[model samples]
Target: MSFNVALSGLNAAQKDLDVTSNNIANVNTTGFKESRAEFVDVYAASLLSSSKTKVGDGVLTAEVAQQFSQGSIKFTNNSLDLAITGNGFFATVPELNSLETSYTRAGQFKLNQDNFIVNSQGGHLLGFPVNADGTSASVSLSTAEPIRIPTASGAPQKSSEVDIRMNLPAGDSFISSAPGNFDPEDPLTFNHSTSVTIFDSLGDSHIMTYYFIKDDPSVNPNEWMLFASVDGKPIDLEDPAGGGTNPVGGNISGPLSTGGGLTGARLVFDSSGDFQSQIPTAANGGIITSDFSNHLPNGADTSQTIQIDFNLDPLGPNPNEPTQFASNFEVTSLQQDGLAVGRLTGIDIGTDGLVRATYSNGTSEPLSRIAMVNFANEQGLKQVGNTAWKESITSGEALAGEGGSGTFGTINSSALEQSNVNLTSELIDLISAQRNFQANSRALEVDNQLNQTILQIR
Candidate 1:
């Protein structure tokens, strides 16, 4: 009986040492929780035995429990790295579309070949789909899906409208040459010129330069001539060779006619340098249309018609719009409604677990919202490998929610949670367990010595 008791004591001490050693080994592990070994003393007595004199039997290993406390967050440079401040776990899946799920506190994640966010174990990070306004479409865990980032944005759209606000100089001199004899290459032909890049249907850029030439006041008072060209090609008002409409095809055969120096729109301003023309609501504010069709780089839409809007807002009143002031000729603002396909620039994770992806085209959209889960009994969770926990019979059902909501913790981007194991405490436990083993061994040796003495007496 003494031998059995000492053997049990030694086994209990060894178990304590093993638990302590494991804690020390994983001291630097991410999201690792420390464990403790518990024991209870056994007694040799039956139900009908004497109640006053009961002898102790041995020590028995009762249970090994885990400690689930908050770990310290270590900030990193990677934006995908995340850390939870309080209680909650990030739900992950083993494969891209796999429904078999796993929970993790380690937030070290990166993009895979298919632009899916995954962990070191290739587990896909699951998230709820979000609306365009950055709100979660559904918060249910069953509705969660793997987060994927698109390589590029939508298709390219051709430039159809241009909004420009400019201040034309009232004190500028008129062109020395007549409108019919004006040349785009010569400086004295046009008073001022401003150019902007516009996109075609195939995402090709075309330089659209607007030349503002001050006209002769003797011919037309408070008026200016606006000459426009695309890629240095003169937009003809009427065919110079023939008095018919200029057809848009292959290439121009001869010089374009400018209606005998009355080719472009006449900017008729009031005497006070204020605009008096009512800017209409049609395309290009009902002013002029530079309609043309030319072959694109990749056989895209060639029939491109761009309306140049002079008024800032087509619907609003033309109060202090583009004016012919006494100041220098300057383009205050110019904007177009065309965009080329954009590449993925970066991603951002908010405290609310919202993942927003930004593109190179100066546009951003919400991709998904990370789902956070919490169990009623964290210690009751079964220890799976790689610093992860699994749902066990002892652990209650997982309650899913977004980060920073209720009992769930908030997500800290660019950060990671370190192991909660205390090295110093583990070392102390190691020493205590070693002493217990030595004491048990000494008791066993004493028992053997007493047995030898009894045999010598017999």
Candidate 2:
């Protein structure tokens, strides 16, 4: 019995040492959780005729339980590197991968060749796919598996509203004939032609500049004629070139916040490539009209935004919509050319886990959402090596939500999750386990010597 007890002590100590060694070995492993091997007492019953108190037993090896504490996050410059700040596992639905379904806190991720978000091993991060409009990619996660994101945006887009600034010379006044036409008594009426160019889906730019020419008050004052021009030709703005009709006929739409409208619009073009505009020319000799506007209005100038919307009823084989990106996403921008512009300038996930982008036009969009996943029974998880873990039946179903929602933490971009194992703690455990194992071996050797002596004496 004593020998058995000593052997059990040895076994337990060995196991404890093994556990500690593992912790120390994985000290730098991302998403790795430290562990400790438990020990239990083994006992034999000394039974008398009527026994109440039981004799104590020796020791036995027990299960190696894991410590599921959060690891410190290390910030890396890689946008693909993810970290779990709080409690939550990154939702991954692997395809053609080893684990059919699993969960993990190891946020070491990267962009695959296909632009699909994936683990270093090419296992993809499963999520709802985003459309061209950047909306919810998934309506149902059941039958429809998480989709892979492609590398490229579907197609480049054309801007809807362009800023046209033609100096009024501070002394010019106009009077027109129509109801919404320029009234000689009103300072709100337009006098010059304002044109803008819009690019198509194929990146072919069309010069659809508007002509804000007020029917030459000296000529037809009753009909504040509205004409549209394309590539320097006097186009019947009411009739766009190639096919579609023009949006601005007489008066441009009013601003949303305040009821302010711009009228006396004309589109003129000289298809002969001999287009000259004295009124619409910029101080730099460049056209004062642009397809996209960058606003930088200092002070309380009440920066304005003109929302010009157009549909994609193209002339040729093209299927797209007329859209524009403005202000750092969600916020609106002014009409000025350049100032404090933060248009989506290459969207990258922020340290806080927010997905935003930047544009040359000084606008951005809310792209993807990042969230960490935590496990109720992290010990119940199956290790997939490479600092990754998979959910097991014991780890319970995962809870999915956005960062900063529920018990999740905010995603800090360009950061990484460091390993949680402490080297010092592991080393201590290893020494303790090693000492116990050594003591147990000594005890066994002493017992063997005593048995030999007793046998010789007998």
Per TM-score, the best of the predicted structures is 1
Model 2 TM-score (2 dp): 0.63
Q: List per-prediction Cα lDDT, in the order shown.
A: 0.78, 0.51
The deviation in Å at residue 383 for candidate 1 is: 1.5
Query: How does model 1 fare in lDDT?
Result: 0.78
The alpha-carbon deviation from the true structure for residue 393 of candidate 1, after best TM-score superposition, in angstroms, is 2.6
Writing each residue's lDDT as its tens digit, candidate 2 over 291-397 gives: 22222122222222222222222232212221111111111211322223223336476543445555554455655555345667767777777666776789775
Model 1 C-alpha lDDT per residue in residues 27-65, reported as the tens digit of each score:
988878889998999987888998688768899989899
Estimate the lDDT of model 2. Answer: 0.51
- TM-scores for all candidates? 0.82, 0.63
